[model samples]
Every structure is written in structure tokens, then in C-alpha cells.
Target: MAVELIILGVLALTAASLWIPYIVGVNTAPDGSIPADAPDGFIIPPDPNVHRPWVRRAYRAHLNLLEQSVPFAILVLLVDRVDGFSALTLWASIAFLILRIAHAVGYITGTARFPGRPLIFTGGWICCLLMAWAFFAA
Candidate 1:
């Protein structure tokens, strides 16, 4: 299999599993800082201030991966469907995977202070943009 295909698979699985940490955080928080529901179908988002720190950060990390995965997967599929294999796309795919991991870790651990986390996320975004361009450049 091509590296891009393999990376795509990894990205999908990673995004799917990213929810595990947040769920664990919710279940483990003894104080019940995480709400079970919104009551009116308002669908409350994760609040960094309201939810437990770990739960909030973990939830955001999971969402961030999910948000990025769609476009990343689409670009990968497009490139693969066209048989567009190139070193640039390959590297971008690999970079995306790495950046996602780093971003998730940094977010969950709060290690990526200030611009660090955003920079890592932007790197993943750039990787997707590169893959999108690969569709044309190929």
C-alpha cells in the first residue's frame, strides 16, 4: 500500500479513538464537573472554564482531530483516487500525522502554552493544504 493510504488509515483510526481520553476524563472526575447533558438540546460545547481542566482540554483535543480529519481524509482520498503519488504529498501526510499527535498531546497536557498548540495545529492545516495542492500538482 502507498504511504498516503497507510497515513490516511492511521489518521482515521486516531481521530476515531481520540474520544477515549475525554470520556475517561469525564468518567474519572469524582466531582462531576463535566455535565451529562444540556437539558434543552442546546448542545453545550466544552467550556474550558466550567468543565474540569482535564476533561475540557481532552474534549477540545478530540474535537480538533475530528475537525481536521475530514479535510485531511478527503485530500488523501482524492490524491489516491487519481494515483497521484509524489514525495511532497507523502511527506505532508507524514507531517500531518505527527503534527496531530503532537497537537493532541500538547492540548491534553497543557504543555503547548501560548502559541505552541496553535502553531502545531496550523502545521497540520498546512499539511492538508499541501495535500490539496498535490491533487492539482500531481
Candidate 2:
């Protein structure tokens, strides 16, 4: 259970660190000023057209991680508390972290045309499902 918690912490940190690319891509204005066209608000919309390909990919990867993280966290915590850490749950958690890392790298590197990114993403989803199944199997 402690190891599982550590893995969850690492995954959460990975998700948080994805903001670095997004901030680098969008926060640096040419004149170091907010775009004049930006509406006055705490949250300014970034122009997607202005972002480089890798930057766009980074942003998308971050969004994808965020989308998956919520459910992943919920399921992991529920399983951890309810069933404790079985071998199946522990391996599934590790596989999920590895697959998510591969997915992010493939997305940022524009390698999705190959079998890497899509397969990793699917594998991560399967890991999530497997984790959920562990709750019932326990």
C-alpha cells in the first residue's frame, strides 16, 4: 500500500509538471506584455495558431493526462482503501504510469503515426479498467 501511494504521488507530480511546457509555450509574449487583444481577465485564452507543433502537442498531452487522471486517482484510492494492494493492482498501477509516460513522450515527439502513442494510451486505459476490476475481484 505504501508503494502504491508513492506511485500515485509520482503520477500526480508528473501530471503537474506537464504545465511547464504549456507555460513556456503560452506565457512568453514577444514584447513581454500581455497580448493587446487579450480580454481583461485572470485567464487569457492562448492562440493555438501561434503555438509551435511541439507546444501544441505538449498542451494536448497535458489535457489528455488531466482527463485521465481524475478517474485514475479515484479508482486507485478506492481500491487502495477497499482492497489494499494486491499484485494485480500494484502491477496495473505501475503499467499505467509507464504507459502514460510513453503516451506523453510520443505525443510531444509527434510519433503517433507509429504504434507507440495510441497503443500506450490504450494500454493505460486497460490498466485503469484492470484496477477497477481488482475492486470487484477482491
Candidate 3:
């Protein structure tokens, strides 16, 4: 349970940090204003047409993290309730968190095309799989 809570805290922080690139990108426009043709009173509407590679990458990564996190949180809680924490569960939880951080960094830095991002993502999945196996095997 302690390890799960720690991972939750880390995930929350990771989600929060994803906003940095988006906020900076939004404010980068001239005078921090939307396009002249944009509807009035529209604040911070996401423009899918954003051309900046880093900003796009950050947004995609943020969404991806969110998608993965929901299931991860559910699985962690289930494991905590059903199997209780053992060495395998604790270590798997830690590994998942670490891999998530690495994946986010690789995504933001545009290095996802190489080995770092994909490998990190795969490692996270493996951790999740281990946790699931622990639940069933117990």
C-alpha cells in the first residue's frame, strides 16, 4: 500500500509537469493572444494545428500517460487489496514508476524514435504484467 501511494504521488507529479510545455507553448504566441480569427473569449483552446514539434510531442505524451495511468492505478489497488504487497509487487510498482518517468522524458525530448522511449514503455507494461500475475498467482 505504501509503495502504491508513492507511485500515485509520482504519477500525479508527472501529470502536473506535463502542463509546462503546453503552457509555455500557448504563451509563446505574439502577445500571448490567439489567432485574429479565433472566436472571442476562447481561452487556451487547443489548436490541433500547432506546428511546434516539442509542444505536439508533449501533448501526445500527456494523453498517453493519462490513458495508461487509469488502468495502472486500478491494477495497483486491486493487487494491494487481493494479494497484498510482496517483494515482487513492490519492485514492480517501483519499476513502473521509473519507466513512466523515463518514457515521458524521452517523449518530450523527441528521442522516442530511438530505443529509449519504446523500451521504457515496454518495461512499464512488463511491470504491470508482473503485478497482474502476482494477483492471480497468489
TM-score to native of every candidate shown: 0.87, 0.83, 0.80
Worst 10 residues of 2 by lDDT: 40-49
Candidate 1 lDDT (Cα, whole model)? 0.83
Report the Cα lDDT for candidate 2.
Answer: 0.77
Model 3: ten consecutive residues of lowest lDDT: 40-49
Relative to the true structure, how large is the alpha-carbon lDDT of every model?
0.83, 0.77, 0.74
The better-scoring model by TM-score among 1 and 3 is 1
Clashes, model 3:
0
Query: Which numbered prediction scores highest in lDDT against the true structure?
Result: 1
Task: State the lDDT of candidate 1 residue by residue for 37-89, as single tens digits.
Answer: 63422223555555577677887888999999899999899999898879999
Models ranked on TM-score = 1, 2, 3
Name the lDDT value of residue 128 in candidate 1. 89
Off by over 4 Å in 2: 28-35, 39-46
Model 3 / residue 6 / CA error / Å: 1.3
In model 1, where do residues sit more than 4 Å from their true spots?
A: 31-44, 47-50
Model 1 scores worst on lDDT over the 10 consecutive residues at: 38-47
